[model samples]
Target: MVKMFLDFVGDKFSASNPIPVPDNDPLDDCSAISHGTHVAGIIAANAIGISQPGFIPDVPFLGVAPEATLGAC
Candidate 1:
């Protein structure tokens, strides 16, 4: 059941490839793509088998809901 959910969400919103932004301009030289990628990582970091320590000691840094689906506008 968990595997199915992961597969479905992964297929729908995998961030392995770069997603295009509507506007190519950045505000004050700040890249919107960079910000978006950071936010996305916070929302869905699938840390199922990672052994490295995350931002917090001993605890793996994972998203609020690793299996949750995500979409960018």
Candidate 2:
């Protein structure tokens, strides 16, 4: 579902993780675009794996409100 939404948006919403020079750390290509997804995950992720930037796989993203409904315009 995440991949589908990303593909559907195409260039409109860029979530490309880029590694920069010197520091050699990954940067959020578009934080504004990422913010919404992060918020949504916190609300209704429903047993999502923790592959996010700083999170550990063993500590997954258990939703704050797993039974919550989500909507978007």
Candidate 3:
């Protein structure tokens, strides 16, 4: 589902104004891109219960409910 959504967004947006693919090593020279920062901001900014994309990257701040039970599929 996530991949499909991303693909759709990429196809739609790329057709008009292409967004460059994220470099494999975005942090090698951090200043070269804002993708990392943008992702971090989104994850940290989510207030609702939705597990938005980039909602938790590292082990630190995992979201608003770090202790909530996450059931298996």
Largest TM-score belongs to which candidate? 1
In model 3, which range of ten residues has the least summed lDDT?
Answer: 1-10
lDDT-better candidate, 2 vs 3: 2
Alpha-carbon lDDT of model 2: 0.52
After superposition on all CA atoms, what RMSD does each candidate show versus the true structure?
12.1, 12.8, 12.5
TM-score of 3: 0.23
Off by over 4 Å in 1: 1-33, 52-59
lDDT of 1 by residue, 1-73 (tens): 1221112222223366445333332222335568876887888887655666444445556798777766543
- Model 3, 43-67: lDDT tens digits are 4444544454765733344454444
lDDT value for candidate 1? 0.52
RMSD of candidate 2 to the truth, in angstroms, is: 12.8
Clashes of each: 0, 0, 0
Between prediction 2 and prediction 3, the one with superior TM-score is 2
**lDDT of each candidate versus the true structure:** 0.52, 0.52, 0.40
Q: Which segments of candidate 3 are over 4 A away from where they belong?
A: 1-27, 46-73
Per-residue lDDT of 1-73 in model 2, one digit per residue for the tens? 2221222332333346343233222232455566767888788876665466666666755678887666432
